[model samples]
Target: MKYDFGEAIDRCKTNSLKYDFIEERGYPADILPLWVADMDFKIPHETAVAIKKSAEHGIYGYTEPKDSYYRALSGWFEKHFDYPIRQEWVLKTPGVVFALSLAVRAFTKEGDAVLIQRPVYHPFSHVVLNNDRKLINNPLVLKDGKYCIDFDDFEKKIVENNIRLFIFCSPHNPVGRVWTTEELTKIAEICIKHHCIVVSDEIHCDFVLSGHKHRILSSLSQEIADNTILCTAPSKTFNLAGLQAANIVITNPELRKQMYKELTRTGYSQLNSVGLAACQSSYEYGEGWLSQLKEYLGENLKYIRHFLAEHLPQVKLIEPEGTYLLWLDFRETGIEPSELDEFMKHKAKLWLNSGEIFGKEGLGFQRLNIACPRTYLEQAMIRLKTAIDSLL
Candidate 1:
């Protein structure tokens, strides 16, 4: 089936955080928003039908996933990445961040140091700090326009801080470099040697661009698998964030038990019926839609690259290898890191995730979600070019 990637959809007044809450979020009412991670596209047709069917059943009571759910979930990982999943290893959660918070409480005590790579998804830091754990950052280094991990610093930070828990963003958020196998191996070896538990967020695993591949951290080896907690969900892939379903894969029995106990302590159980229905059906039947979406996104990426070079030369696009979010560097425009937000909001009349929110390393940078129609990007680029022109 041919999907309409350019279809127009009105999201305003739908209680959308990205659309309706602009004024509440301290941005001008008329500013176009491309900040939040959710896509502007609609969910796949199969997923919608499954959700509608479940919703019409009338009993929206607490629910647990059956064997069919496990088959569909495991089937996806096996089919796409050649990573097999065991039924017992799966633990359903409300979302990945929620599961991360539970992992923080499960794996480490208060004041224990937890490590993360900076300029990552902000919620990583939040899960650590809000849980009363000490936060340690090993910031990624930008080498020749691509982000790379400083392995020495990563290991040193773990030893110096006595870190036991590390949150890793795979195919990384914001600055989108998919980790090669060599990179994944070194990380796994260091974490294993240091006895640091790795909570690997592979939420964007399915969105790798052409010429790159996403490797599951735990799939490296049995030793690494024992020390890893893999976080995944169909929310980002299928545009079902509102449904609130995530799968936390833990190969280590003890670690799985610990996290599940912490989850139970919070009195949270059973994913919503509609979310379960949507997730299973999407994984089972939405592959055709996803394939076409990736192709559309690839074109959007090309358009941005050409648009920036031709018109907005001052803005540097940090070439992305995965995910729809593009990290844009505005430092060349001579805009002070502190003033970039104001400039984007008031001058450009646009709403994007300020780089500083990710970390100090993100200063003078902005994360733009490009999972919308090409027309949206066209309008955003015009507004940005006009804004930059006014500065001169």
Candidate 2:
């Protein structure tokens, strides 16, 4: 690989949330942070160069994306994801979560229900509930260690609660499962029938593993496309989350207007200066880096599987079809949710996202981010094994 995936870069003193503020997050300063979604990898060389070039110019003014920005974004999607994104359909945001909150405020009124599938990204529920919207969850069924959408429960709840907006996580977070075209079609069909607007979070869409293919939820059909708000970002793909850049794509003019107005109320305008450069450069020049990173990440996943099999066989790694996050099931260990969290935090000295935070169904599960250097991952696993062995 041209890029060094094994290089361990110390993130301390960088004011990184995942690195610097471990104690504040309730983990020891010495804790191995394998929790956050951001990767330990550096941004592509070209993307770094672009940001550096802008910084050297010494003009720190509010900036917006030029034509090149849209071309880069559109070209990348067309080439990689097979989704043709029109320039007009794109709206820039600081981050996907911020955009999601804006979308909730725009599309749904307070007291209206918004549907989400759990265990999902915790922020999905946060955005809905924090906005005073009624949060409805149609939990995903874990069958044979793979997560499947509950289509009947999904539609039934939509009808019963009069859900106006649906936050759909494609290539879902925490629990990684890339929705197949057939699954996406069923969801779109439900949304269209229910007169619901689908806020499809496609941020992790680019991270699917070898066997699975990511189908753009909106790209399935025109009706789906018109009813969809496709939220995407180069942050997770290129490790530019600190720069805080994302794009929200809306094809329907009416829905687009509603979202745009909502965004304006939040006093949000103009993209981050460095973030735009990082995003454009990454899309135009970072595909090779991303391609190799995906392979390396697959290796990381394999390492985790083998490590657990040999050491902590009681813990099952839920097979992930996409994303670098691994959902580890510890039910066989007979650990309760709070106890499991304590074991990971205090006993293992490993900082991981407690599964119950995703939703109640995620009890006895822990989400470990495997997007870091292999050496650190090995250390984390050893720590975990030591903790488990203590129970024996």
Candidate 3:
């Protein structure tokens, strides 16, 4: 591979929220972090080169995304995902989280209920609750070691609460099940029937593992697309979260105008020029690098699964359909969430996200970000095995 996934880049001295700020985040500084969902690998070379060129220009200025940028992004979707997106539908935001918050504010009022599938991303809950909206959890059911949507429960809750908005995580986080096309259709139908707006966060769409394809919820149909506010970004796939370039696509003009007005009201207009360059470079010329990165991540997942099977048999890995995140079921260990948190931090000398934060349903689980070099994961597994063995 031209890019080395095995190479461990030193992120400790950098202002890396994942690594450097561990102490600030209340985790022990000595613990190896596997909690945050960003890659340890350097971004694709062309993206770096593009950002560097922009930096070399010396005048940091406010910017709007160029047609070339939109073309690159749209063209990428067309070539890679077989989905064609128009430039008019695209709204620029610094990050998907912000995009979600914008969507929440745009579509709903204070006291309106926003629905989400729990044991999912923690921020979905945050964005809803923080914005003064009522949060409704439709927890994903863990059956036979994989997560599945409870369709009846989902529609029932929406009807019961009269939910005003739904925040959908595609290629869901924590419990890494990629929602099937049929599943997305049902979700869309339910939202349309209920007159609830859908915010589909497709940030992790590009990181799908082999044999599973990610279908943009908007691509389901024009009606579905019209009802959906799709949030996408190159951040997750290209290791550019800090760069914060999200492309929010909304098909309905009034919805687009509403979101744009909210964004303007919040005083967010121009995007960072370096981020723009990075995003354009990534979507335009980073496919080969992404291919290699995905291959590397695939092996990393396999390594972690095999490592657990051989060393920590009691801990079950929920086979991931997409996303580099792995949801490990450790309920059999019989440790409560707080105790397990302490064990991982103090005894194991490692940091992994406690599943409880995702929702109550994630209590006995651990969300492991496997987007790092294999050597890092192997070391983590060794520490984890030692810790679990001691407990057992």
Candidate 4:
């Protein structure tokens, strides 16, 4: 492979949230962190070079992306997802979460309801509550070893709560279930019928595993496109979260206007210069690197499956369909939900995201990020096995 995912680059003292602040986050200083969504792999060579080029220019003035940047960004979506994006439909933001917060304020008023699927990315809840909006959850049901959305409850909640906005996670975080075309269509239909604006966060759209496809939610129909705010970024794709750049697509003129108004209210504009260069470069030249990274991640997934089956069968792998995050069910281990975090930190000496933070439905489960080197995963598995074995 042209890209080496096996090399473990030291992230310590880099002020990395995942590596540098373990102790500050209440985990042991020595604990191995597999919690955050970012990868441990180096970004594509072209992306790094572009960033260095931008930095070497000396003056870090306020910068905006050129038409070429938009071409590259649009070209990526058209090539990968077959979704054509009008350059004017794109809005730049620091991150997807920031876009979600902006959408909440733009589309809904205080005390107005916004719907989200539970056991999802925690920020979906935070964005609503933080903005004084009503939070309504349509919890995804686990059926026959897979997570499925309850469409009836989804529509019911929107109608009952008078929800005007829906924050959606495609190829959802934590559980790692990529929404099928049929599923996305259903969601789009429900939101349209209810006249609710959909903010589809597709940051993990590029990280899908084998045998699954991620459809852009708005690409289904003209009507769906009119009502959807599609949030996307290269942060997860190229492991450039620290750079903080995201492209938010809003096709509807009125919705875009409102979002622009909210963005103006925040007094924020133009992505960081380095982030702009990295994003444009990655979208243009990082495909080969991303392809190899996915293959390596697929192998890492297999390793976890085999290791767990052979050494820690009590823990059930939820079987991720997309993203590098694995949702592991430890219910069979007889670990109480309240004590699970302590067990992972103290016993396993491994830092993972406790499922409860996603929502009540996430209890008894843990979100493990496998976007690191195979050796890191092997060590994490051994740590987990030893921790579980101690109970016996």
Candidate 5:
């Protein structure tokens, strides 16, 4: 059951977004890509075996998920987090991002105000604007390099704008934070008071680090659950994002009805045969693989912490309670945004997500994907050290 995470798999010729799109991304070809959210590791062996078996039939006909697929989806939730999700509550979707847009269309009006925390996943804003909904920013507060909800500001925005919906990022991205039960309670109260429907994106829920547990926002209370639309997938956990599968869970009967109606209106298609096979195999047999991978990622985070401390002392490493993405604060490096981008591209030969893409709050911050082989990580660290040295 020992997985080979250290092996450098060749991904250049495979039409990889992380590899083949460098020129399109306006970065030098030699720059190592650490920008995309997907990891460089091979998909789980169990998932691969299942996919191959499903492909052997050689018929890519239209398909619907069998009972086993439903069981796998519900069983994983029940077994791991003890969250009981009935079969009736689950709605299949091709992608979480697509689901977000669908939820916006389903629940809100064209001009309805949708609130999103700043320095959040970039797509949250993109989807809202594209769907003709007014975007409201309730930026997270940076206190001691740890990000927390500005609840007072959140309440203010809800009241001031008559915000119709709130899109939340649990165990939030970039500045990784697993919102505690108390925080969730307060947030749920505010959303309820404002009569705002909540769309909680918990896609990265399972990849949390030690001492942190993911709290499903809807599970906190019945009223909160009624108004909440929960989105999740096995993509990040099992490294099967290419499978193009995700679940939209709504426990409230009326809300579920509305979402399904929207799904049909949008002409949302059925899940692919391979996606179903991969999801079943991953949910059933990929737990041990995930557990070990988390351990490896913990070590990777620790290595980055030490590297920054010993070498690039000017940069701040915000310790994450969840997710493999390391949010680096390079403000102290005093490099302009353009100069920093150049350094990462040319001098360091690394490609990380520019924080500015997230929001203005992300200025001088960069999100580094550390979910790769140790050798690759070490090389990236060396490049980072050299970049800083050149600046000095």
Candidate 6:
């Protein structure tokens, strides 16, 4: 492999939020930090070289994204997703989190409702409420250990709440289902009918593991594309979240105008210089590295599935179709959410995301980020098995 995903890079002294803040976050100091979505792998050498080239210039002046930046991004989207996006449709932002917040402001009024599918990335709920908009949750239905959209409840919420916007997570976080083309089309159709401005956060789009293909929400229909704010970044895919580069693609003239206006009003027009360089370099040259990383992650997912089946029969992996995150159901273990948290913290000495934080529906589940070296994953699985054995 051209890039090393197995090498254990020490992150302790780097002041990484995932690594350096475990004590502050009330977790054991020695606990493996898999709660945050960031990976432990080194940034691809090509990306590192690009950042070094920029740093050698020694001028940290305010900067804007160059034409090359746009080309790199547009080319990547086109190549990977087969979705042709115009450069004019692209708008840069510091992060996808910012993009979601900005979309909340741009599309909805102060009191209008924004609907989100629960057991989603936690930030989606906060983005709506933080902007003084009402958060209407249409929780997904989990049947036979697979999660699917509850279309009945979704339509019901839209009608009852008069939802003005829908924040959709494609290649969804935690549960990790890559919505199929039919699913995307149906979701788009529902949003179009209700006149909901759809904000499709596709940050995890590039992280879809083997056998799962991503369907870009905008590619479903022109009507959907026009109404959709498609957000993506190299952050999750390339492990460059600290660099904070993300984009929002709006094909519709009016929607684009509104987002641009809101962005300008907030003085967020300029791109993060380091972020832009990382984004451009990663999209253009990190393909080989990403390919290997996905292959390695596929192994990790397989190990997890087999490990759970062999050792912890009560806990089930909700078969991740995409994303490095694994959603594990502990409901059969009959552990209360609070008891599970204590066991995970003290007994397992692991810091995984408690599913309840995603939503109340997340109870009886925990999210495990598998984007780490094999040795660490082995240790995690062993510790988890020990903890569960003690509980039983």
**Order the candidates by lDDT, highest first — what do you get?**
1, 4, 2, 3, 6, 5
Task: Please say which candidate is ahead in lDDT: 1 or 2.
Answer: 1
Across 1-392, the per-residue lDDT of candidate 4 in tens digits comes to 29888998999999988899877777787899999899999999999899899889999998988899999999999999999788899989999999999999998899999999989999999999999988999999999889999988999999999999999999899889999999999899988898999999999999888789999998999999999999999999999999999999999999999999999999998999999999999999999999999989999999999998988888999999999999999999988988999999989999999999999999999999999999999999989988888888
Alpha carbon lDDT of each predicted model? 0.94, 0.90, 0.89, 0.93, 0.88, 0.88
Whose TM-score is higher: candidate 1's or candidate 5's?
Answer: 1
Candidate 6: worst-modelled 10 consecutive residues by lDDT? 265-274
Estimate, for each residue in 86-201, the C-alpha lDDT of model 2 and write its tens digit: 98998888999998999899988889899999999999999999999999999999887789988999999999999889999998998899988889999999889989989999
Question: Worst ten-residue run, lDDT, model 3?
Answer: 333-342
Single out the weakest 10-residue window by summed lDDT for candidate 2.
22-31
Report clash pairs, candidate 4. none
Off by over 4 Å in 5: none
Query: What are the per-residue Cα lDDT tens digits for candidate 6 across 224-293?
Result: 8998999988999889999878888999999999999889988866776788898899999989999888
How many residue pairs clash (N, CA or C atoms closer than 3 angstroms) in each of the candidate models, in the order given?
Answer: 0, 0, 1, 0, 0, 0
Q: What is candidate 2's local distance difference test score? A: 0.90
Between prediction 1 and prediction 6, the one with superior lDDT is 1
C-alpha RMSD between model 1 and the true structure = 0.7
Question: Which ranges of candidate 4 are over 4 A from the true structure?
Answer: none
Supply the global lDDT for candidate 4: 0.93
Model 2 clash pairs? none
- What is the per-residue lDDT of model 1 for residues 131-211, given as tens digits with 9 covering 90 to 100? 999999999999888999999999999999999999999979989989999999999999999899999999999999889
List ranges where model 6 is wrong by over 4 Å: none
- TM-score result, candidate 1: 0.99
Q: What is the Cα-based lDDT of residue 287 in candidate 2?
A: 90
